[model samples]
Target: MEATQILDVARDGILTMVIIAAPVLLAGLTVGLIISLFQTLTQIQEMTLVFVPKIIIVYMAVLILLPFMIQQLVELTERLMDLAISLP
Candidate 1:
């Protein structure tokens, strides 16, 4: 494959990955922010307070967004396959 085609594929793969990961990452970020704010307000500085909630939220987000993630990945794969088939 030419460099441009290779770059395009790489870009597509990266964009797809980012799209798939955004929901989980955003969920974790939102939970962490809220926990931090609560701790600041209440003065309860428990370092481990963030982990469980963040993990649970992220896990739930993943579970909920799983289908969308899979669809994005499948689309990326199909595009790559099409490109390969058309290449040679």
Candidate 2:
């Protein structure tokens, strides 16, 4: 493939990665922020307190979003394979 074609593939790969990661990342971020705020207000300062909830919430988020994530990944893979087949 030409350099431009390679670059396009790379760009698409990055975008797919972002799209796939966005939900979990955003959920974790929001949960972390809320937990941080609670800690700041209550001044609990217990390390596991933050870790456990964040882990649970993230896991739950993953479970809830799993199907959608899988769909996007499958679609992206299909598109990528189509591109590969078309290349030669």
Candidate 3:
């Protein structure tokens, strides 16, 4: 592949990765922020408070977003395969 084509592929791969990861990461980030706020407001400084909820929420987010994530991956794979087939 030409350098430009290779760069395009790399960029697409990265963007796809970010798209797939964004939801779960955002979910965890949001939960952590909200829980942190709650902890600060209520003064209930439980060590496990931040972790457990984030884990559960992130997991739930992944479950909910699985189809979309898989579809993105499949699209990426299709693009990669098409590129490969077009290559000399």
Best by TM-score: 1
Q: 1-88 in candidate 1: lDDT tens per residue?
A: 8999989988998899889888799999999999999999999989999999999999999889998998998899899889888976
Judge candidate 2 at residue 4 and give its lDDT.
Answer: 93
- Please report how far candidate 1 places residue 43 from its true position, in Å: 0.2
* Candidate 1 ranges beyond 4 A from true positions: none
Model 2 misplaced stretches (Cα beyond 4 Å): none
TM-score-best of 1 and 3: 1
Q: What C-alpha lDDT do the candidate models reach, one value each?
A: 0.92, 0.87, 0.94
Q: Each candidate's TM vs. the true structure?
A: 0.97, 0.91, 0.96
Model 3, range 6-50, lDDT digits (tens) per residue? 899999999999999998999999999999999999999898989
Per-residue lDDT of 6 in model 1: 83
TM-score for candidate 2: 0.91
Model 3, residue 9: distance off in Å is 0.6
Model 3 bad stretches (over 4 Å): none
